[model samples]
Target: MDPDSVSTDNILLPRNIEIIDSKIVNLSIILFISGYISKVEISKFSHFRELYLLYIPYKFKLLLRGSRDGFTPRKFHESCDNVSNTLTFIKVKGTEEIVGGYNPLRWESSSSWGKTNDSFIFSLKNNDINNAIISDIENSTYALNYYSRNGPRFGNDINIENPNSQNENYNRIFCKKHHYKKKIRDSEEDFSIEDYEVFQIIKC
Candidate 1:
């Protein structure tokens, strides 16, 4: 069978593979290659999708890639500001951990706090979906922080500090327990990221 010619809609899995939930499985595979970054896997993305609780099917449209687009606050805002319903995926450097947040409100260059109860932060384990951890917003008023000089900040919990140098270590991306219900990362110390991607969630 020609792999490239096989359409996602009618593609068939091996007969030996068990079909527990076909819809979720299919959606996972389709969305994984649909312009989303390579760090997030099918199962992990599927779990993230379930967290949204949207009635209609949605697709992730890549808005910005930190490595490809540049890891600066100015660059982030230029590409992502004004775009609503964005899902960010950050690959932690030197670890199998992938942490991110979902903002239902539009990102802005002006400084302000975005209020929305639908926002959430999460950590996905690369090998297992069951190990994923999701932290819901405890305070809607501080759900998201939009600043002209910083990357995405989820209520001071998961903050991607504006890069000041070319070295990844100076980026200082960190996660701490704050407005969210719980901490997504095991530690509250600052860390660096391998790469990150922001996607606009579009309902179809």
Candidate 2:
């Protein structure tokens, strides 16, 4: 299995939805709110910034995991069934909507990917499923860059990440409610979903 780098040959007009809540602190009430702090009513601070290919892996994994119960891979894909393959779980709706990019401006690739996730599977025995997951991530991301329409070529833009931006208000509240309780600051470990002891926000 050959790992492909970001393809420079195509029209890499890659855009990302980019969410803020880097980690869940309290219950979903407040989130970390990536990039900047909120100045307004926190709840109304919803801003979506369109970033080019930056630390995409970091941003993407954070955004992906933040929505999970505890950022666990299984939690990310609820549609996975107990399959007989070497890799038991699969990303059921992994391809759908690419969702949230519903803005009438950019081209939506997520919808197409969601449609493809069903067919995309990596058998651990055949090609190292973990590796495949990584590959798929890259492939999916790279594929996003190629999508071009209406001469302008838009990326699947959406509101996420920034709190002050008119789009990610809810996310800001989610971050403040979920700040890392331990405050164990180390350069090596920033403490992600796995570090958080509690799964559900309120232990209902």
Candidate 3:
């Protein structure tokens, strides 16, 4: 062997894998509601680095009655861009059920809502508050037409303010208002809700 030949063993190489330790994100949606962001427990399965919290006031949530419709508030478009997962957590008013779901898609402001083919909404069923089930993924689009403010105009047949109406009977999760005046069927993807705090899970 020639003494001038360089030894490959002495060559330095870059690391191929960067190990990251799991840590809790300091983001607090509760802060906006209760003026606190820490100690906000979330399901461990919510693997996110950053979270944009949106608090839906109970007064505003009262309008979520009736069928499922797309509902967006004044500042709803503030976080509509980018690819992110929407995690909604609802606390039933008259029951002990704390249920919500995750929509794996970007909230778009386009003509209609743009969604990924892997869209799904899951709920925290009994005996498993942290582990939610994948309710559905067949529909590429879970969120239909979007509407801001009071939603679409309806006839006298529907009483949006009636406490005994289905709207107030079964509190639905925080979602958008639609353009059409029809009942949004509660399927696997469309789960019922009450008072909820929505968060947009984002990666750093």
Give candidates' CA RMSD values in order. Answer: 9.5, 21.8, 14.6
- Candidate 3 to native Cα RMSD, angstroms: 14.6
Ranking by lDDT: 1, 3, 2
Q: Write the per-residue lDDT of candidate 3 for residues 128-172, one digit (tens) a residue.
A: 433433333343443332322211111111111212332223322
Model 1 regions lying over 4 Å from their true place: 1-56, 163-170
lDDT of 1 at 168: 27
lDDT of 3: 0.32
Local distance difference test, per candidate?
0.69, 0.20, 0.32
Candidate 2 per-residue C-alpha lDDT over 1-204 given as tens digits, one digit per residue, 9 for 90 to 100: 347744333443244533233332221122221111122122322221212222222221221333343333223223221211111121112221111110111223222321111111111112221222111222233222111111001122211122233222122111111111211111221111122111111100
Model 2: lowest-lDDT 10 consecutive positions: 96-105
**Consecutive 10-residue window with the lowest summed lDDT within model 3:** 150-159
Candidate 3: residue 192 lDDT (0-100):
41
Name the better of 2 and 3 by TM-score: 3
Residue-pair clashes per candidate: 0, 29, 12
Candidate closest to the true structure, highest lDDT: 1
